[model samples]
Each structure stands twice: as C-alpha cells, then as structure tokens.
Target: MREIFIERRDRILRIAVKEKGQLYECFIEEEEERNEPLCGEIYKGRIKNIVPAISAVFVDIGHKRDAQMNMKKGRTYKQGDEVIVEVLTEQIGNKGAKVTEEYSVAGRYAVLTVNRQGLSVSRRIKDERIINNLKNELVLPNDVAVTIRTSAEDTDVLHVNKEIDSIYEKICDINEKSKYILKPQRVYGENSLLHKVLIDNINNQTSKIVVDSKDDYELIKKYIGDEDEIDVILHEDYRTMFDYYGIEREIVSLRHNTVNLKNGGQIVIDKTEALYAIDVNSSKNISHGNKFDTAKNTNMEAAYEIGKQVRLRNLSGMIIVDFIKMRDDKDKADVLNALRKAFYNDKTNTRIYPFTELDLVQISRRKKGKSIYSYIEEKCEACDGHGKRLKLSYIENLIRNEILRVEGENAINDFYIELSEHYEKSVKGDIFTFLKEIEGITKNIYLNFVPGIDSFKVEPLLFKKQVENLAKYKVNNIEFC
Candidate 1:
C-alpha cells in the first residue's frame, strides 16, 4: 500500500511518500507566503547575449543572475529578442537558473507543450489499446502539442479530453495576453506543492493521502475533484502525520553520512564540491561459502540503497560508487543491471555508465534544486566550514577570557556557561576552577552542557545578556596553554 503525508512546517511544506512502510520519495517546497522561485514558473525573458561557441544564450529574467538557455541546433536567437521560457532548474551554487525554449504546462491528465509538436504518452502505461485510444481520440489545437500523462490511464475518456482542452485553452489565453506585454514578465506560475503532489500521483496506487492542515486538506479535496477511490484524510490528531508514520525519523537520518543496509552492510555518502562519492562496506561475512556470490549480493543491496538515498537526499551531479570488488564479468553486469532497474521509477533524468577499469561506477543525475544536505545543515562557524574544531586549550582560554569579561561587567549576580558535551568533558577541571573563582566574585556561577555545539556561550543569568566569546579568540591548533 502507498501512503502520502503532507505537513506544513513554518514556511515550508514537506511531502513524503511511503510504499509499504518504506519511504519512496520526499519533497520540500517553500510556502506561498515565502514567495520563492519555483521549478515550473514561466517567464518572458529578453536575450542579453549569445555565445555561439557554447550554443548557449543568457537572458534577463528579473532574477539576481541571468538565466541560461541552451539553444538547439539550427535554432537562432538575437539580442533583445523576447522569448518565453520555463525554468528547467533553479540556481545552484553560483550558476544561474537553467531555462528552456521548449516550454510545457502540466495538468493533472496531460501536459501541453508550446512550440514542441508531438503527441506522446507516458512510457509507464504499457496498454497499446489505451495508447492508441489517447492518440486517436484526444483533440488538441493544431499549434499546441499534448502528452498524455500516466494519470490519464484508467481515467474516463471524456474527462481526459476535457482536461486537455482546458489546458490548451489556458495556454491560449496566456499567449493572447502576452501579445500586449512589452517587458520581461512571468506568464504563469505552477500550482502549490499540495496540488502538484495530488496531480502527479493521483492515478498511482496511492491508497491514502493525509494532510495535517485543514486548509490544505480542503485544497487537496478540491484538486482531487469527486475521485473517491483514494482516501483524502484530514489528520486532526495531535501527533503529526509524519510522526505517526515515522517519516520524520527517516528525514532526520538523511543528515547522517552512513546508511545501514538490511543485510549487515552499509554505504557511506560524502559530498564534495565537484561530485558525490559513495563507498559500500560489508560489515559481516556472508553465510555463503562463495566470495563472488557474497560480493554480488552486497553490491546489489548497495545499488538499491544508493538509488533510495539519492532520491531521498535529492542528490544531483556526478556520483561515483565504489562497490565491493567482484571478479566475475557476469557479476559486474548483474550489479550494473540492478542499478539501472532501481532508478526506473525516478522522475529526474539519470544516466548510469558501466564500471570503470578501477571498478568505480559513474552515474549522473539532473539537479533540480538545492541538495538535501544544504537544506538541512548549515556551515559551522567555529570550524570555519572545515567540520573540525580548534585545540581544547584554545577553547579553554576563550572561555576564560569570556568569564573574565563577564566578571568585569558586574551587571548580574550569576553567570552561566554552556558548552557541548565533548568540550565539557575536556575542560571539566578548568571549568570547575573558573566557576569557583567567579563564585568568589559574584557569589553565583553555573556551568551547563549541551550536545552538538562545539562552541561555548557565556551569559549573565539576571541581566539576560549573553555573549558568544568563541569569536573573540583566534584559533591556534598548535598552542595548548
């Protein structure tokens, strides 16, 4: 059974899909209140410059950076030409948003393509009769092209044709209004995440859809529109739907570098500036006597987990996986085949190449938005983004200086110092002595320990004035005292 859970977390809407209790996919979208740039927004952009050598053009789309459009062969563009484009991918790192000339507006049943001429059906639907019916029966405008989506399958023929007609008319209205526009503008913005999730997966084998917010539940009901097979549930329980389904735990685990497989194996994922490196590790010896069989089994497990992790984390760019060494040619082929099959359900464009001479598998996936790591984790200030800390004595001296500074202020009766559990253990003796000295001066001093915080905080209990003294001291790894 498939279940979808939607939760509104502050200004972000998080969606998680689970199939038979395992997380299949997850998405994070900013709420409309935040007014963030979405994936499917259409913009009328003016061409700023054309680089013929690269076959790419830069356009001013009212974003901080110019959007890039990769021109196809025989396609010509001139400066100051106003072209309508859709955002293919959002800005990543220093690169601008990737835009495309071939724009598509997606509806629940079909997607209307502008300028691109072709009637295509989703590859998932294998019924030739259904494909032939859609191809022959659906009527679209001459200029507009339509692609029958997977959701169109098993749906009423009249409903599918009506939806196609409605989307075509909507695009026609947008084009008619665009004739009067003189500058760069947005032609259309995609629907909210809730609507998008329902539209994209309504025809799938989803048995239940749960939303925490009543407003969003109503919105989803309106989008589903009289479809009663799928249960659209409004979860009014105090516990969130994510918590109820244990999806929150899975999301939290995405931050970890290691993933444990079912068969006593693990995969470690490391993200660098250029690419993602994954290493497969077998924790226990296989019960099977044959080493090749054990390696193949572990490699197959890693391949499936890699696909799941890539989707869960929304990892993109080049990925290199170091699978357990398999000596047999057939074993290598089997592993590669497993990897390809695992990514069949992925929505993003992904290409997997065979193993290299060094036994590393190379895979490339389309990057649509910020990675999951960047979304959840921030650069550490104390480590200066290196993910390491300075010497213990250096931190201790920094703490001493902070205590002295607070003691000199004499504004409050008590002082509180908060440090991470690790740092607390390292400086316990020094902290005790410092607290005793401060107690002599102010008659009240306290030390608190917190987890995961490398730096320490010093504050006056009465005045409520806190000072982060780690910044005032320079980091010296070599110096001890």
Candidate 2:
C-alpha cells in the first residue's frame, strides 16, 4: 500500500507520497520555485580559495554562486589546476554550494560516476556478470567524466552506450570552448525535473509517472525510452490524475506532520537542532493498562510513521527516536522487529538499532545535504526553536515567588514577568486569585508568554525604555550586542 508521484513546478520538482490512499509526504527538490534539480552538473570554474589548513577549495561555477570543494569530504587535488567537479549541493547560503570531485551523474536504471572506476551494481540486482557485460561494452568517449545510473539496469547496452557517448561528447565540447585556464567558467549538462524524478524514485513500487506536460514526455522518452511497456505514463489531463487519487487533499496534510496510527496510538514528531524526537502517546482506543501491551501498541504505531517518513521526507543520517519504554524484553524485541520490517520497502538503505539506554531507538540513513523540512519551512518565530513548551505547576511556583518578592518591596508599581505558556496556565484566573491571598501584595504584575521555560524577562511597566535598554544588556551570560 505505498505510492509516489512526481510533480514539476515552474522548474523545481515536488514529490507526492501516499500510503493506502492517504497522502503522507511532499518534498520540493530544493528552495527554488522553478527550474529543476542541480545535482550531477559538470561545471568548469576558477579556484576561488584554497586553504591548506582546512584542506578545502572554493570555485566560482559561473552560475550566480560559487561551487565549494572540501579536501577532506572533497577529493584531493593540488591548487590552481583547472579541474571539473560535479554539483553536489546547491549554493543558497553563507556556506557555498557543496561540490565533490568524486560524484556521479544519474539517469534511468544506473548512476554513472567518473571514468573506468569499476562498477557497483545495486544490491537489488545481484547479477555480477550483467554489470561486467555492460562495462565491457562501455568504450571511452575521449575521457569525459560519467557514472552509470541505477535506472540503466536491464537497459539495452547499445542504447546506454549511445546516450553515455552523447553526454561525454558534450562535456568535452565544454572543455574545448572554455574561455580561460583560471578565470572563465562553463557548465556542461544537468537533468530536467522530470528526468531526475525517474532516476531517483522510479523503483519497484512506482506504478506510473503522471506527467502533465508534453515537454516532459519527450525528455523522459529520450532518456528512458518511449516503449509502451515502460511505466512512464503521459497524462492528457492532470485533473484526472489528482481527482482519481486524492492527491490534492493529501498534499495539504503533509505540510504539517500530524501522523495518525492505525493501532489507536499517536506520535508527536518534533524536529530539533540536536536530533528528531518522536514521542509515542496512547490515544483513545489504545489505552492498554499493561506496560508491555501499551509499549508495543505505541511503538508499533510509531514504526509505521517512521517507515512513511523515511521515504516521504527523505530523512537521513543519525535519528534518535524516543519510544515508550517497556518492562519485558520480549515486547521490546517484537516492536524492534516490526520497525525493521517496516523499512524493508524504503528506497534508501536504513539501519535500525534497538532502544538505547536513554530509551531511544537509533537509526542511520545516508544523506546528501540539508533535510526536507529545512528546504520548505522556516523555524517558528515565537518558540525560536527551543521546543520547550509551558507547564501549569511551573507557573504557580514562579507566581508565588514573584508575589512574595512584591509584598516585601512595600512600594512596587508594575512589573512584567515573561515566562513560557505552561507557567502562565498555572497562574491564570483561579490560581492567581488563590496565590495572591497568601501575600496580599499591592502591586500590578503582567505576564508575558516567552515560549520556553529557560527564557525569562523582567520589566518595570511604568519605566519601559529604561528596563528595555537594560533588558538586551542583561542576560545569563551578559554578552550584550
């Protein structure tokens, strides 16, 4: 019950993911609104900076941005040599675009990395001779960089060789036409949005590719072949594609992760700077009193969400998920095995480990760059990303302390107390009235919801500007700006 769709926007690409007719995830290829993915682009550029200390170099790839190369994460090369590197990460930050000397350009069926560097047949295809046979047929098209794409699996050798040759000839042409040894730059070949989607997502479960544009059809046909047997389906009307599939309503929900589980438990997923945390909670139907049953129920619910998230968001690297703890080791084993089996359909290679000492399950997946969330959403302005919410009991304590301090002052006018929402809820109408009875303080105090428990602010409401000026100056460390 898994499905995926590729939607081309302006020039950028967005993926539509669904499980059992429910839309689970959506991903924009990058930050740009229009115009295709940039990975596997062969660019000619001048060395911008070469720092031996960092063992990194930056190159201006003649686009609006500079291409970066790290000798550590980047391959080794001496300075001032005019060299070719593929665009690994797009430049959109204070940090330049990430580029690698060791890179591959992808196409349907296979990924072609530079030169005769041996073949790595995907684990899905175990036929070693099939790969060797393809490699033997691959003759040099005059030493231009290329890597065979995964989509090229079972592809005709003659067609693969012809397309690869066409790409290599184009790379050589760029080198010949470049204006200078150090200053001038040129770009060779890059894939369109439709082309990239097929190579990246068109695997075992891709039922069909629904393309609204005819231009995409020709490009897809060019690379993957126009045979009727291919799953690439050209759409005459996009309305039918979405209406028959409920793609529109599903995409809207994916914007905010409100993942619901079938077994009557829910998980709240919050992404933090340190790591992504998933808190499993028991919902209405899943209120099993036994610790093992409850833990297994929620963990099983969480496992389904995790599986959908792996492909939907294309999350990568180290992930530490907090699953509700269980007393029995057998219940733990059951949940762990379920999670492992859930990820079997994932396109990316995923490694899952049992719950750690912190009661957190650790997962690792390979990532190319920034996450899917970072590409689409900005951090919340109010919370400012500490993810610390408010509590009622905490507010009661702070208010009691503030009330006692106010009565002791004898002559106090107005004060501003800034705290998190949880704290404010503790000292709202009824609680505030009951607490004030103990101190009988004759002072006006205002409460400000500051989003996090660690955050604190004090203000003399009457003497606003004076306290405000000192407000920015006085902090925990007092590192005034």
Candidate 3:
C-alpha cells in the first residue's frame, strides 16, 4: 500500500512517501530556502544587457543578482525592454538564475505551453480511442499548445478541460498583472513541491494521504475531488504527526552511512568531491548454493535498495556502484535489470551505463537542488571540515521538540527557555512566531537570554502571573526573548 504523509512545522514543510511502511521518498522545504524564486516561477523582467555572442541576455528581476535568459533565433530585444520569462534553473553560487522566454503551466493531467503548436499525447497512453477522444474533446487557444500527460488516460474529460481553463485563466491573470507594472518583479509562482508530490505519486495506486494542516488538507481535497478510491485523512493529534507515525526516526536514519537489507546484505554509501560511491556486500546473506548464487542474490537486493537511497537522499551527478563479484554475465545482467527497474519511475533524468570491466556501474543524474546533507548539515569547524554538524535551524527544531516533550509530561504550561546571544541571533523573526504554536498548547512560553551559555536551557516558571506583570524587566542582567 502507498501512503503520503504531510507535516507542517515551524519554518518547514515535510512530505514523505511510503510503501508498506518503508520510506520511498522524502521532500523538505523551508521558508528560508525561498529567498530566491524557485524554478518554474514566472517573473516580469527588464532587459539589462545583451550578449550577442552567446545569444543570451541579462535581465533584472528585482533580485540582488540579475538573471540570464537565452534569446531565440530571430528574436531581438534591446536594453530596457520588458519581457515575460520563466525560471528554468535556480541560482547556484555566483551564478544567476537561468531563465527562458517560453512559458508553460503544468497541471495534474496536462501542460499548457506558450509558443508551441501541437496536441501531443504521452507515449504511455497507447489507447487509440482515448487519444482520439482527447484530441477531439479538448479546445485550447489558437496560439497555445497542450500536452496530455499519462495521468489523463483514464481521467474524465471535464476535469482535464477544467484544468485547462484554470491554467488559461492564470495566464490571463499574469498578463493582466504585468501590463501595468513598469518594473521587474515576480508576477506569478506556484507552490511546486506539494503540487509535484500530489501529481507524481498519488495516482491509482495511492491508498491514503495524511496531512497535519487543515489548509493543506483542503487543497488536497480540491485537487483530488470525488476520488472515492483513496482516503484523505486529516491528522489531529497533540504529538507531531511525523512522530506519531514513526516517520521522524525513519528520516533520521537517512543520515547513516550504512543500510542493512532485509536478507542481511549491506549497502555502504560514501560521497567525495568527485562522485558518490556505493559498495554492496553479501555480509550474512550467503546462501548454501555456489558463490555465483550467493553474490547474485545479495547484489539483486542491493540494487533495489541503492535506487531507493538515491531518491531518498537526492543523490545526483555522477555515481559509481560496486557490487559483489560475480562470474556469470547472466547474473550481472539480472542485477543491472533490477537496478533499472528500481529507477524506472524516477522523475529525474538518469542515465545508466553498462557495467565496466572491473564491474563498477556508472550512473548520471541531473542535479535539481542541493543534496539532503547540505540542507541539514554544515561543515564542522571543530573537525577541520572533515565532519558535519547539524545546522542551527535543526538545533532550533530540537529545542522545540524538547519544549513539546516537557509540556506533554508536566502539568504546567508556563516555561522559559534561556539561550546565548550567539544562538538567539540565528532566529529570524519574533520568538513568539517561533514558539506560538507551542505556546498554544503550553499557554505561555518565555525566552530568557543568558550570556556565555553554549546552548540552551529550559525551565518552568512557578509564578506565571508575576512574570507577565514584570514584562520586559531584566533580572540579573538577563533579558527576555
């Protein structure tokens, strides 16, 4: 059975996809990660400089760094001209966002593209009648084109039409918004993460969806309206939804370097500046049969697990895998086939090459964003950059979890957490904004700033009324947070 769990926390949103209680994929988005507009976002930009040699132009989209857009052959534009552009790639390091003039809006069942002129059906949709019916039933604008997605095969025509209408209306709104704006700024953007998970994973095989936020539940309900085959559940619990469902521990397990298979096999993953390396070992999974049989069985299991780990960790770029040595070419072929089937449904563009003479397999995947480690960890100064330490945001989350645990165990809802100035500076907004959700359950939570402290300390307040009356008063040179 396939299930999706959506959890919303302070400054973060997490989505997990599981099959038979095993985590298949995880996606996390934080508020601070949105400092730049994500890929596929639309912006009305002002042309800044043109580079004729590369056929690209620089655009000012109201960001500190200017974006770059490639010009089509026969398209001409001068500086200070206004144009509509879509972000094709995110900004990396010193590079600006890569954009395109061609705009597109993707829906669950179809995608509408500008400056393209064709009605194309997905290769997966092989039914002649369905293809012909969609071609005849759908009506689009003369200038725009539409592509029928694989999910549209068994879908109702009216729903597809409704999505087209919705997309066109959105396009109209963007045009309307851009007409009056003389400056470069964002015109429209989609919450791509949630929509992507829903569109890609929640299909005919999806059995259940559990979301903690009511607003997310409503959005999902509207997206998958009247789908009686799947269950949409709203998680209402005092404990965090991820913790209640045992997904929190599973997510933490991804940080480990070794993965143990069900049959006593092991896959060890390591990364360097060059490429990610995976080693498969038979370990205790040796069978009573010959060496080839033992190696084949373990390698086959490891192949499947490696693909799952790649998606879970978002491992991209060049990757190398070393499987247990096998003599028979047929066994190697079988192991390779298993690995291919594992990544058959992966959305990212991945290319797998044949096994080399030494039996190392090479796989290349397009990079989307930073890896899971980059988001959650930082270089450890104490270890001289050889190790990684959790980021301050994650530490803040641990503090929040500790606060929740204390509130759950004790009867009092009044408490104050003391943090050093170094830790307090990491917080972006008001302390109440960070702890308000906790305060809703804990009633009143206060922050006490103490100097020279390494981390944080949480203590209960005996006199809640007295503490509130003396609001901003400093006691022994400690200020309130």
TM-scores of all candidate predictions against the true structure: 0.78, 0.63, 0.81
TM-score of 3: 0.81
Q: What are the lDDT figures for the candidates, one per model?
A: 0.75, 0.58, 0.80
Clash pairs, model 1 backbone: none
lDDT of 1 by residue, 197-277 (tens): 666766658788898888888888887777687898888754456655677667757878998888778899998879999
Poorest 10 consecutive residues of model 3 by lDDT? 472-481
Better of 1 and 2 by TM-score: 1
lDDT for each residue of candidate 2 in 208-321, tens digit (9 for 90 to 100): 555556776676666555454446566654233443455644543444655777777777766665566667776654577776787788887788787776666666767777
Error of 2 at 60 (Å): 2.0
Instruction: Give the range where candidate 2 is weakest over 10 consecutive residues by summed lDDT.
Output: 472-481
RMSD of 2: 15.0
Choose the strongest candidate by TM-score: 3
Off by over 4 Å in 2: 1-13, 17-25, 29-37, 63-65, 72-79, 126-186, 189-192, 203-207, 230-245, 285-289, 316-318, 327-354, 365-481
Q: Candidate 1: minimum summed lDDT over ten consecutive residues — where?
A: 470-479
